[model samples]
Target chain A: MAVLTFLLRFLPFLLFGRKERPSPVLDSLNKLLPSAIIAVLVVYCLKDMNFRRIDNFVPELIAVAVVALLHLWRRNNLISIGGGAVVYMLLVQLVF
Target chain B: MKAELRYAVRQTLPVMIGYLFFGTAFGLMLQNIGYNFLWAMLASLVIYAGSMQFVLVSLLAGAFNLPAVILMTLTINSRHFFYGLPFLKKFREMGKAYLYMVFSLTDETYALLCSVWIPDHLDGKKVRFFIALFNHLYWITGSTLGALGGALLNIDLKGIEFTMTALFIVIFIEQWISATKITRVPAVVGLLCGLVLRLILGPDRFILPALIVTVTILLVLRPSLDRRSGEKEEEGSSVPSKR
Candidate 1:
């Protein structure tokens, strides 16, 4: 697992290390892919939700909503994540 | 060097807090699953990727399946492949520390490196190295402490895993808020692809397919995207300095 993870990190440099300039296609990807991949990660984190049950999904939805709204208001990482996680813990521990 | 170190520390303070909490949570989880502090230290020291390390805990607890481990590592850490792209030229300039730089480019470190403003008097490379090193040290310390805490102090943290999800959402919002016109396309593409694939393929198998599809679509749309961004570059608004 460690070797594979390192190899993935090393792959880009190995491919483009010697090139004087990356191709237009590669450059475009460099410019565009970061935000896209990050958005995908957000979705990936929520993949296990079984929407058929309200209890299983409601807490997550409320928590995510809190994270988003708090982030938008304060624009602070610590506040957004910390606030959302606390709300989640409360909901899971007591409400649902 | 002193000035650079001080600046790096100040810049990485937020990451320090985040890593400490997140790492402790990871340590607590691993310990709960019967792994000792040694394992937590080793994983944090080597893997260095926060989310992947969490996944690693589960993998280690389960019956060892090499193929499953390989695939999970590839997909989970694949984002690191892109993280290195913008830094390739800069990292290459760092000489022997280049390998270490690549290995330590976790999401928080990458974001800091991309967005932080180094002072004009300080060497950018040195500051970057310090930032990376400090972040890694915090993670190692946090996880080791968490593992020890788990062994010594029993506490209920039932919903603590939600931190991982919350972190991702924070990152997604950061990216979205900072995205320019040309970059917004891929963000939308990723979300739609991820959601569609998740609904169709189910959660367990959706990520890889979503990534492949997103990449293919982006590649096909590259020309127009390139042209749009090029125009923005001409207007001198290319890179937005984000915090």
Candidate 2:
């Protein structure tokens, strides 16, 4: 799977972009294989998306949003990702 | 350092936004399923891939079988099949962490990898390395927080799994807009294959098959793609090459 992912991710560069690959066959193939196997796995997940699942999925969405905003504010300091996660925990877990 | 970091962050801003939503959604959903913050954190930090982690929660909640888990993991992460193929040597040069880096690789990070043109300049290496590291760190943090979110807020999460889909669309748009020439073929192939696989394999098992078909075709046709690209490069540059 990872082998497939490696190929998919790097194929663009192999096909269209510039970068002299030492071994396009082995390197590119090995790089993207993960995503391919992942593609198969996640599809099953889409089928079972019920209210129960969605309800749980909500807070995660909120957390992700907070992190994103923090990244923008911090201009990608990465500290924001950490801080935002913690803040999200407090708001969701403690405050409310 | 300040300027570079800013640009680095700016470069990652879109992904950060994407990751936040999905990561948080993942946390909430997983926690809702029955795992605690520790489990969630472990998955996020170790497994690190958003889609797979989300699916994993359900697996853990229900029947955490080894075969199923292995298969599901493979299917969900099939997108990684070819990520480093062309850049194997580059990654190989990355030394020991190469395997771990590959382990941590996710779709969003992959998207970032696609956009950034790693130049041959002196600072280029640092920039590319940081780019990969920063993206990984962001995801880890997001996942840990999400696990925390699940632990703390026992509320209804509601429609958050859409986070992954939403992010996919955003990256799709960015790549679609920026792409020119040689990119069109794979895009069309991937889409058509994905759609077809969805129909044949049904929604629950389409992504992996689609990826399989796409990769096989690409590999077989690699020489042709390479040739066409070489011709195009000839028209644009005055460089001599020997690979």
Candidate 3:
């Protein structure tokens, strides 16, 4: 597992690091992929939920909405994440 | 060096909080599954990838299947392959620290390195190295403490895993707020690809396909994206071109 994980992380550096200039496609990816990948990751994190069930979905939806709104309002990472997680915990523990 | 470390600490404060909570949860989970602190430390030391480590606890608990383990590791961590792209040149410039940077580039660490700013007076390489190192240290400490304290500590953390989700959401919003017209295209592409593929393939099988489709779409759209970015640069917009 360790070897494979290292190899995956190392592959791009090994392929591109030594090049004087990488292909323009890669350069474009460097710009484009981060935002895209981050978006994918947000979905990935939520992927396993059984959204058909209200108990499973509502708290997550509300918490995620809280995170988005808090982040937009404050633009503070910690506040948004911490606030959302707290809301999630409370919803699961108390309300939902 | 001291100033760089200080800046790295401040910059990584959010990650520090998140990792400690998240890592401790992982450690507790592993301990519940009968792994000791040594195992937790070792996993955090080598495997280092956050979500995959959680997946590993299940893999270890179940019947040991090498093929399953290998496949899971590759699939879960495959997103890492793209992470090195932006840092390839900058990390190579860091000499001996390059490998460490690559090894420690977990999702949060990579996001921090990409988004944070270093002071003009500070050595960007050293600051980046410290950021990577500090995040790694936080994970190790959190997991180790969790493993060691698992039996004694019995707080309800049922929904705390949402922290990871919340963190990613915050990052997505950050990127959205900062993204230019062309940059936003890939994000929408990724979200749509991920959503559509998740619907088609279900959750377990969507990530790799979403990534491939997103990349292909981006490539097909690259000429237009590149041209627009070039025009933006010519207009002297503050957005830094990736190259």
TM-score value, chain A, candidate 1: 0.90
Task: Indicate the TM-score of model 3.
Answer: 0.91
Relative to the real complex, the DockQ score for model 2 comes to: 0.10
Each prediction's TM-score versus the true structure: 0.81, 0.62, 0.91
Q: How good is the docking of model 2, by CAPRI class?
A: incorrect
Docking class of 1: medium
Best by TM-score: 3
lDDT of 1 by residue, B174-196 (tens): 77787786778998999999999
Leading candidate by lDDT: 3
Write the number of the candidate with greater lDDT, choosing between 1 and 2.
Answer: 1
- Residue ranges of candidate 2 with Cα displaced over 4 Å: A1-96, B118-122, B150-183, B232-243
Lowest lDDT sum, 10 consecutive residues, model 1 chain B, at B234-243
- Candidate that scores best on DockQ: 3
Instruction: Please give, for residues A8-95, the per-residue lDDT of candidate 2 as tens digits.
Output: 4445445533445345664444433333323333343333433356544555556556655655455333355455446545554554
Name the DockQ score for candidate 3.
Answer: 0.79
